[model samples]
Target: MIEIKDLHKSYKMGSNELHVLKGINFNVAEGELVAIMGSSGSGKSTLLNILGMLDEADAGSYTLDGIPIKNLNEKIAARYRNKFLGFIFQSFNLIGYKSALDNVAMPLYYQGVKRAERTEKAMHYLEKVGLANWSDHLPNELSGGQKQRVAIARALASEPKVLLADEPTGALDTKTSYEVMDLIQGINDEGKTILIVTHERDIANMTKRIVNLKDGIIIDDSKVEQVKASANV
Candidate 1:
């Protein structure tokens, strides 16, 4: 579903260049739940950004669902992002004034989905995330978990091939984190390819595979027995 080979990224700082990702190689198959785990400055976030097509790699290749992801114009990049990737951020990234339903519908709006269809798809995903009853509530009106669920629903509304979550359970309490992970696990069970970037061991264990990054390279990549988040919840 996703492929990366010899990936390299860097940023210029004044006269010096900060090498972020150095010769990283990775691949993810369809219907797999994977976690990218790293400490500060380990380059996991850079890898995520490249995988999401939010940023370009200075070197190497990335192919998503048979489409080469290099040297595209912003218009084409945005189109591919909408067509291939869904994102879940730690902060939820919801508009303060938009209700949960409206927030979920925003992506569909960008895709030029009509009002009626957008509303239908938004409500369907909201219900899937167990947030149908809170559709009218604004981000400020919901709990942290509820807000993240709304974000997840918004991400899924586009029906992208890959889901990339950055620190998905970082802000919540343990129980709430488990609940969110449970929700994510359920989504993966239904054959959605999901990649979560997190530092928390327990959260990474919830996934089927863990890719450990250090100093801009993958240090360890291994599959583990998946731990069901529902048990922890």
Candidate 2:
């Protein structure tokens, strides 16, 4: 569903340049749950940003769901991003003043989904994440897990083809993280393609494949026997 070849990225810092990704080639198939694991400064975040189309690569080719992603104008990029990608972040990125339902509905709102239909779709996703009863609660009122669940629901509400989660369980306790991974695993079982950028080995093990990044390059990429996060939860 996704393919990238000979990708390279760099950032300039005054007179020096930091090369973040070096000739990276990667692919993710439909309905696959994959984890990109790396330590600090390992370029995983850069890779994720490129994959999400939040940032353009300095050089390389990226194709998503058969569409080549290159030199997209901002307007067209935003349109494709909304149509094909859903993002979950470590921070849970919810508006403080918005209720859970409103937070989940925000993406759809921007997509020009009508009020009633967006509300209905958001509520369905909230319930899918087991947060229907907490729809009216504010982010501050919910636990960290609940807030992340709301974020996941918000991501899902877009019904995008690919789900990109960066450090999805990074801010939660062990049990809570496992529970969230369990929810994520369940979602993948239903045919959604998901990619997780994580630094935690255990978190990566929960996925079907692990892509290890070091020194701005993939050192290992292999499928493994999946570890069910629910067992740990």
User: 1-233, model 1: which lDDT tens digit per residue?
Assistant: 99899999999999999999999999999999999999999999999999988899999999999999999999999999998999999999999999999999999999999999999999999999999999999899999999999999999999999999999999999999999999999999999999999999999999999999999989999999999999978
Give the alpha carbon lDDT tens digit for every residue of 120-146 in model 2. 999999999999999999999999999
What candidate 1 gets wrong by more than 4 Å, as runs, is none
Query: After superposing candidate 2, which stretches have Cα over 4 Å from the reference?
Result: none
lDDT agreement with native, every candidate: 0.96, 0.95
Backbone clashes, each candidate:
0, 0
Model 1: lDDT equals 0.96
Worst 10 residues of 2 by lDDT: 198-207
Residue 138's C-alpha lDDT in candidate 1?
89
Residue 1 displacement (Å), model 1: 0.7
